[model samples]
Target: MPSMIEVRAPLEIKVDPQGGWELAFWVLDSFNYATPFRAMLIEIAEALAQHPIRSVSLPDYIVDEDFVEGTLLFNGSSLRVYYEHALSYLTLANDDRGVLTIVAQRVQSRIALI
Candidate 1:
């Protein structure tokens, strides 16, 4: 059996238009230092492609009501990636349609910034 949690696109991609690709580059650039991070990112992308919601679990940090601030998770660990640094925010909603809408709005806002 697979993990109960499913991995989706990096949350940053939904909030930041350029964030996804930019993150890809950063991961590549910092391959030496960010190897684990990069690997986790790739794993997330792959999991999303295969099983968007059934492949990974949400980071505990996101579950905190006080932690309105978002961060990145990789290597089964949480890594702080500031909102300003993100190209987009990846939202997970109870409803699939809601998730798409939230992600879309964030992407639009990110595009507007450019």
Candidate 2:
């Protein structure tokens, strides 16, 4: 399994003037080292933000009407984004199982470990 770390800060969902959506990222003090990773996340976020809530396509790993959880692969990294949707905003979703946190991990190649 890859080592995962939650991105607790620097994530925000923004609303466009035309009622579309976008994901904004602030300066993450500790995450400055992962510029490429952040870029990939931004690309994914933009894809999801450009569309309407109900119309957005999410991974079918967890089937729920309002909550979504799925892992995405970009090159050699794995990113997981999960959140609950309201009428106009995204909320941190939690349940008896646990909170679905946004996390990222690098998928290292086995041959590279040699």
Note the Cα lDDT for every prediction shown.
0.30, 0.31
lDDT of 1 by residue, 1-110 (tens): 22221222323323333232222112222113312332343344344342324334434432212212333433233323322113222233222234434433433322
TM-score winner:
2
Judge candidate 1 at residue 106 and give its lDDT: 34
Q: What is the C-alpha lDDT profile of model 2 across 1-114, one tens digit per residue?
A: 322223334444444333333332232233233323323333444443322233233554323244344444332333333433332122222221111222111111111110
Residue 26 in candidate 1, Cα distance off native in Å: 13
Clashes of 2: 0
lDDT of 2: 0.31
- RMSD of each candidate? 15.1, 14.8
Q: Total clashing residue pairs per candidate?
A: 15, 0
Could you tell me the lDDT of residue 34 within candidate 1? 18
